[model samples]
Target: MTGDQTRKLALVRNEVDLSEGDFDPTLLAVRVEEAARRLSIGRTTMYALIRDGAVQTVPIGRSRRVPVQALSDYLAQRMQSRPINAVA
Candidate 1:
C-alpha cells in the first residue's frame, strides 16, 4: 500500500475508545477534519464515508459532529457481526 494508505491503516488499527464525555450530543458539532484525524482517515475519505453512510454524522448549523457513542457502537457492531472460524 502507499504511504497515505499505510498511515490511514495504522490509525485505523490503533483506534481509541471514546469516553462518555466525548460523545455527548449536547456538545457542538465536531469539524470533519478533526474527526477524520481521530478516525485515522484522510479528509476526503471521511467525507466520502459520510456521503455513502458507512459512518454517521450529526449536523449542527453549518457543521457536523459524530456522536462518540456512535463510533463505539459502530465498532462493537462490526466486531460482533464478524463470523467465527474454527481453529485448526
Candidate 2:
C-alpha cells in the first residue's frame, strides 16, 4: 500500500475515539477500503455486502463512500441474528 493508503487504514483502525460519539465529521463517510478495515473485513467482502444491500454506500460524484452509520447498522444486524451460545 502507498503511504496515504496506509495512513487511511490506520485512521480507520485506530484514530476514532469510541467514547466521544459516533458522529465524527471526518468519518461521516469513508472510502470502501477504510470501511472494510474498520470492520476488520476484506475489501472484496465489503463490496459484496454493498452489492447485496447488506451494507449501504453513498455516491459522491464518481466515487463510492460508505457511511459510518451503515457499517454500524450492518454489524448490529449481524450481531442480533447471531446464534446464542455459538462457539466464539
Pairs of residues clashing in candidate 1: 23-68
**Candidate 2 off by > 4 Å:** 1-25
Give, for candidate 1, the lowest lDDT window spanning 10 residues. Answer: 19-28
TM-score of every candidate = 0.51, 0.68
Scanning candidate 2 in windows of ten residues, the lowest lDDT window is 16-25
What Cα-based lDDT does every candidate model obtain?
0.61, 0.79
Candidate 1 residue lDDT tens string, 1-88? 9986665554443342433224323333355665676666788987887787867888766767766665566667766777666242
- RMSD value for candidate 2: 8.1
lDDT of 2 by residue, 3-47 (tens): 867766666665644434342346688878778877878989999
For all candidates, the clash counts are: 1, 0
Clashing pairs in 2: none
